[model samples]
Target: MEKSIIIGLDIGTTSVKAVAFSRGGRVIGEQEIAYPLSTPFPGWAEQDPLEIEAATITVIRNLIQLPTIDEKNILAIGLSTAMHSLICMAENGEPLSPSITWADGRASLQANRLRVEHNHIYDLTGTPIHPMSPLVKLIWMKENNYLPYQQASYFVSIKEFILYRWFGCQSVDYAVASATGLLDLHHLKWNKEALELAGVSEAQLFKPVSPTEVLVDLDKTIADQIGLPVHIPFVIGSSDGPLANIGLGAINPGEVAITIGTSGAIRQIVTEPKSDSLQQTFCYGITESLSLIGGPTNNGGIVLQWLKETLDIKETYEELISVAEKAEPGAEGLLFLPYLNGERAPIWNANVRASLFGLSLRHKKEHIVRAGLEGVIYSVFHVGQALERLAGKPTTLLASGGFGRSPLWLQITADVFNQEVQVPISHQSSAWGAAWMALFAIGEVTDLASIKQAIPMQENYMPNPDHHKIYMDLFKLYQELSHTTHSIYMK
Candidate 1:
C-alpha cells in the first residue's frame, strides 16, 4: 500500500510552487519554479499569463515525479493563488493581455478619482480604493481604450484562467473575487453598482463559487502528462491571505496572523463580514460564514531586498539582520517610512514614495539599516492598531513568512506589537492551507480545527518589557510623522 498524499498548488507573483503533503501533516515532496514580473512602463507591473500557466504545470509535474511520491496515491489537489491579478481573455482561452498584478499602478489616476468621488464603494465592497483593485484597473482600461480591454471576451483572474484551462469552466472562488473590488461582500454576489462603475456587466465576469467547491475529470492529455488520475478531486481553495491563517492555525477568534513574504499582511478571521469605517483595512471572504478583515502592506521582506540591492551590500539576509540588531529598538531616533512600492492599508496611497526622516550626522550605516527593518515592523504595527480598534486585541500573534527565519526579526515583531509571537515549523502557510482544504474536501480531514493539532509549532517569542516601552514611545512620533507627511506625498 502506498501513502496517501495531497498536493497544494500556489500561484504566486514571482513563482509557482507545488507541495505534496501526507495526511499526517508532513511534507512529502515539493517543487518550485520561478517566473519574472515585467515592467513595461513606470508603475506598470505585469506578467505573461502563458508563462505562469506553463510554470504551474511544470511544478506539478515535477512534484509528482519526486522519488518519494507515487502519483496514483495522490488523493487531491488544491489551489491557492495571489489575489487581484487581472487577465483579459478571448473566447478560445487565449489571453488578450498580460496579467496585471496587484502591484500595478497604471490605474492610479482612476483609483484616486473613484476614492474621492465614490468613497461608498469601499464601504460596500470591503476592498480599499486603490490601484490594486481590478475595479479601478477596469476603469483605467475603459478610459484609455486599452486594446485588450476592448477585444476581451472575458475578464478573469489568473486562478480563474488556470481553472478554465484545466477543467473547461470559468469560475472564481469567493475569496479571490471579493478582493477584486467588484464583489458584494454582504450578499456574496457581484455588485451591480460596481459593474456600472467599471463599465462592464455580470456577463463578462466569472461565476463566483465557494472555496470548497470541487471539480473532477481533468483534461485527459494533461492528466496523463502529470501522471494523475482523470477523476482526482481538485479543490478550489481560497486566496493566499485567508488561507495563510488556516496554515498557521490562526482560526480561533482573536488569533492574528502576520505574514511578511514579498509583501506583508495582518489578518484575523471573523464570524461575520465587517469593513473598516476609516478604510484602514479590507474585508475579504473565506467561506460563506467566515471573512478575513485585515490590512496588507506593500512593503515587507521586499523592502529589505530593496535596501540590500540599492546599498550594494554583499551580506546575506542573516548578516544584514545581525547588523540591524546592533542598533537599539528605536534606531536612535531615526525614522523610515517604507512606501518604496507605494502603500496599502493604513494609508492606501500609491503616489507616496519612501522617506527617511530625522536623519542626522549621528546616524550611521547600521542605524539606517535598522531603521528600515524597524520601519517595516512599525508599519505592520500600524495596521495591527487599526485591527485592534475594529476586532479588539489579538490574543496571539502567529507569525509566518521569510522574516520568521530571523530570530531578531521575530523578537522585534514581538516587542513592537507587545505580544507573544508564535512561529509555525512550516513557513509555507498558504500551500499548507491549500493542502488542508483539499483534505477537508475529500473527507480525509474531519474538521477544520483538527489542523491545529496536526500543525507543529515552535517556541514562542515573548516581548521584552524595556523594548516594548521604547517602541511604544517611538510609535507616537512615527504616527505624528506619518500624519504630517500625508499631504506632501499627495502633492
Candidate 2:
C-alpha cells in the first residue's frame, strides 16, 4: 500500500524549498536550495530569475528523489511564494531586469511622494504606499526612465515568471496581485487608475486567477527534469502570508497568525475586504469571499543576528538565547528600537534607523542580548497592534517561524501581546498550507476548515502576569521612542 503524498513548493526571497507531505498532514521528505540576493546598489535587492528557476527545478527534483518519497504516489504540487517581487519581462518571456524583491528600498522617494497625493489608492487596493509595493517600484522606474522599464513588454512577479516559463502563460494568483497596490480589492481586477498612475496598462500585467485555480500539463522538458508526469495538476496557491495562516490553521474566527522569520507579519482572516483609515495594514485576497488583513515588519530574527555579530558573540543562537533568558523582564531599563533594516507597516517609512535607548552602565552582555530579543518581538508586537486596530482583538495568537523554536522568544511574544500563543508541531506553515490547497483544488478535501483537525499542536505559551505589566509599561516607552526616531527621519 503506497501512501499518497503532495508536495508544496515555496519560492522565498533567498531560496526555494519543496516539502512532501502525506495525506494525513505529516511530513514525508523535504529539500531546499539556496541562492544569492545581489545588491548592485544601495537600497537595491535583486535576484537573477533564471538562477532561481534553476534552483526551483533542482529542489523539486531532489525532494522527489528522497528515499521516503514515492514519486509514483505523488498526487499534486502547489505553490506558495513570497509577495511583492517584480520582474520586467520581454515579449519573448526573457527577463529584462533582475527580480526586485520586497526588501528593495530604491523606491522610497517615489513612495513618499505618492503617499502624500494618491494616498486614496491604499483604501482602494488595501496595500500601503511603501517601496515594497510593485506599483511604487514601477513609479520609481517610470520617473527615473529606467532602461529595463522602457524595454519591458510586461510586468510580472517572480511566481508569474516561473509559471510563464513552465506553462507558457502569464497568470498571477489573486493574493499576490492584491499586494501589488494595483488590484482593486472590491472588484478583484487590475485598477484602471492604478495602471494609469504607474504608466502601465492592463495588457501589461498577468491575468488574475483564484488561488485554487489548477494549472496542469507541466512543460514536458521540466516534467522530465523532475521525473514527474506532465499531467500532474499544480494548484496556484496564494502568497506566503495568506497561505501561512491556512498552514497554521488560524483561519477560524478570532485566530491571528504571527510569523517571525528573517522578517515578520501578523495576519487575520476576514470575511470581506477591510482596510484601516491609518493605512497601517494590508488586505490581500485569499478567496472570493475571504481576505487577509495584516501588517509586515522588515525586522525580525535579523535584528538578533545583527546584535550577535555586533557584540562579537561566538555562541550559537541557542546558547545566546539561553544566556538571554537569565535577564529579568525589561532588561533593567535597556530598550532597543529594531529598525536596523528600515521598516514597513504602521510607520511605512524606509529611512528610519535603529536605536538603543535607555542604555545604562548596569546593562551587561546578557541584558543586551535579552533586550535585543525583546526588541525583535516588540517589532512583531508593533505590527500586531496595527492588525488589532484594523480587525479588532484576536482571541488566539498563533506563532510560527524560526523564532518560535526558542521558548524564550515565544514567551516574550505571549507576554508583550498579553495573549496565549499556540505553536504548531510543524514549523513549515506555508509549505503545509500549500499542500492543503492542492488537496482542496483536487477535491480531496471538503473545505478549508477541515485542516484545523489535521494539524497537531503543543501546549500553549501563556502570558506571564508579572512580566506582562513590566512589558506593557516598557512598551509605552518603546512607542514614544519609536515615534521620536521616525520623526527624525520624516523631517
Candidate 3:
C-alpha cells in the first residue's frame, strides 16, 4: 500500500528543517540541518544562497528517498522560510551574491536615511525602518556595493531560492513578501519607492501570491534528484513566523504572538488594515481575513546560545532552566541588554552592542545566565506593550519557537507580559499552519474558528502576581537602561 505524505520545509536563519506528515497533521519523518552564517566583516551576516538551496535539496532528497516511504503517494510540498534575508541572482536564475540575513547591520545607515526622508518607512512597509529589513539591505548594496543590484537580475527572499530549485520560478507567498519591508503592508504589493531605492524593477521581485496557491510545477531537474516524479505540486509558502502563528492556532484577531528562535517577534493578529500610532510596530496581512501586526526584536534564543558558549555552560537547556529556576525572580536586579546583533522593533539602533547592567561581585554565574535569558524574554514584553496599546487591550498570548520547551521561559514570559500564555503540545506551528492553510485552500475549513477547535492545546501559563510585581520593577529598570544605553550608543 502506498502512504501519502505532505512536506513542510522550514528554512531558518541558523538551520534548515523539513518535516513530512500525513494529511491529518501526523508527523512521520523529519530532518534538521544547521548551517553556518559567514561574517566576513563586522556588522555583516551572510550565507551562500546556493548553500541553503543545496541543503534544502539534500534534505528533501534524502527524506523522500528513505525506504518504506511510498514515493507515488506524496501529496504536496510547502515551504516556510526566514523573512528579510535576500538573494540577488543573475538573469539565468543563478545566485550572483551571498544573501544578506535579517540580522545583518551593515545597512543601518540606509534604513536611517529612509526613515528621515520618507517620514514613514512604517507607513510604506508596516515595519519600522531597521537594518533587519531586506529593503534596507538592498539599498545598502546600491549605495555601498552598487554593482550587484545593477548587474544582477532578481532580488528575492529565501523561499524564492527554494522555489527556483523546485519549480524554476521566483514567486513569493504573501507572508514572505510582508517581511521584506518592501511590500505595501496594507495593499500587499511591492512599494514603488522601495524598488527605486533597491535599483531593481518589479521584474526582479517575486510575483506575490497567496499561501494556499500551488505555484510550483515540479521541474524534471529537481524532481529526478529528489526521487519525486516531474509535474508534482509545490506551494510558494509564507514566512516561518506568521505560519508558526497559524500552526499554533494564533491566527485569529486578539491573539498575541510570541516566538523565540534565533530571533524573536511579538505581534498581534488583527482583521483591519491597522497601524500602530506609536510608529513603533509594523503590520502585514496574513490573509484577506487576518492581518499580522506586531514588533520584532533581534535577539531571542541567540542570547541563550551565546551564554551557553561564553560561560562554558555546557549543561543542557533543561539543566540550565533548573539552574535558572533556583535564581531569584528578576535575576536579583541584574539586567542584560540583548543587542549583540544590534536591535530592531521599538529601539531601532543598530550600532549598539550587548551589555549587562548591575553586574557586581555579588552576581554569580547562574545570576548572569539567568539575567540573559530573562532579559531576552523581557524585551519581548516591551514589544508586547506596544502591540496591546495599539489594539486598545491585550490578547491571548501564544508562545512557540524552540525556546518554548522550557517551562521557566514560559512562566517568565507570562509574568513579564502580565498575561496568560499558551503553548501547543505539538511543535512547529508554522508547519501546522501551512497544513491548515492547505486545508483552508481546499475548502475543508472556512475560518479560524474551526481551526481553533481542531488544533489541540497542550497547556497554559498564568502570571504570578508576586513574580509579576518583581518583573514589573525589573522591566522598568530594563526600559530605562535600554533607552539610555541606546541613545548613548547611537550618538
Per-residue alpha-carbon lDDT of model 1 for 1-491, expressed as tens digits? 75488888889888998988877668888899999999999999999999998888789989988899888888889999999999999888899999999999999889888988999998889999999999999999999999999999899999988888889877889999999999999988999999999988899998888888899989998787676788989999989998889889899889999999888999999999989889999999888888999999999988889889977889998888888877888889889988899899898988787889889998877888899888899999999999999999999899987888889889999999989999987788888899998888878888676889877788889999999999888889888877766667777
For candidate 2, which ten residues in a row score worst on lDDT?
Answer: 383-392
- The number of residue pairs in model 3 that clash at the backbone is 4
Give candidate 3 misplaced runs (Cα > 4 Å). 1-4, 65-69, 442-449
Candidates in order, TM-scores: namely 0.98, 0.98, 0.94
Residues 87-119 of candidate 3: C-alpha lDDT, one tens digit per residue: 888867788778888878888788778878875
lDDT of 3 at 336: 92
Separately for all candidates shown, the number of backbone clashes (residues 3 or more apart, or on different chains) is: 0, 0, 4
| Model 1 spans > 4 angstroms off | none
- C-alpha local distance difference test of each model: 0.90, 0.90, 0.78
Question: What are the C-alpha RMSDs, in order, of all predicted structures?
Answer: 1.3, 1.2, 2.1
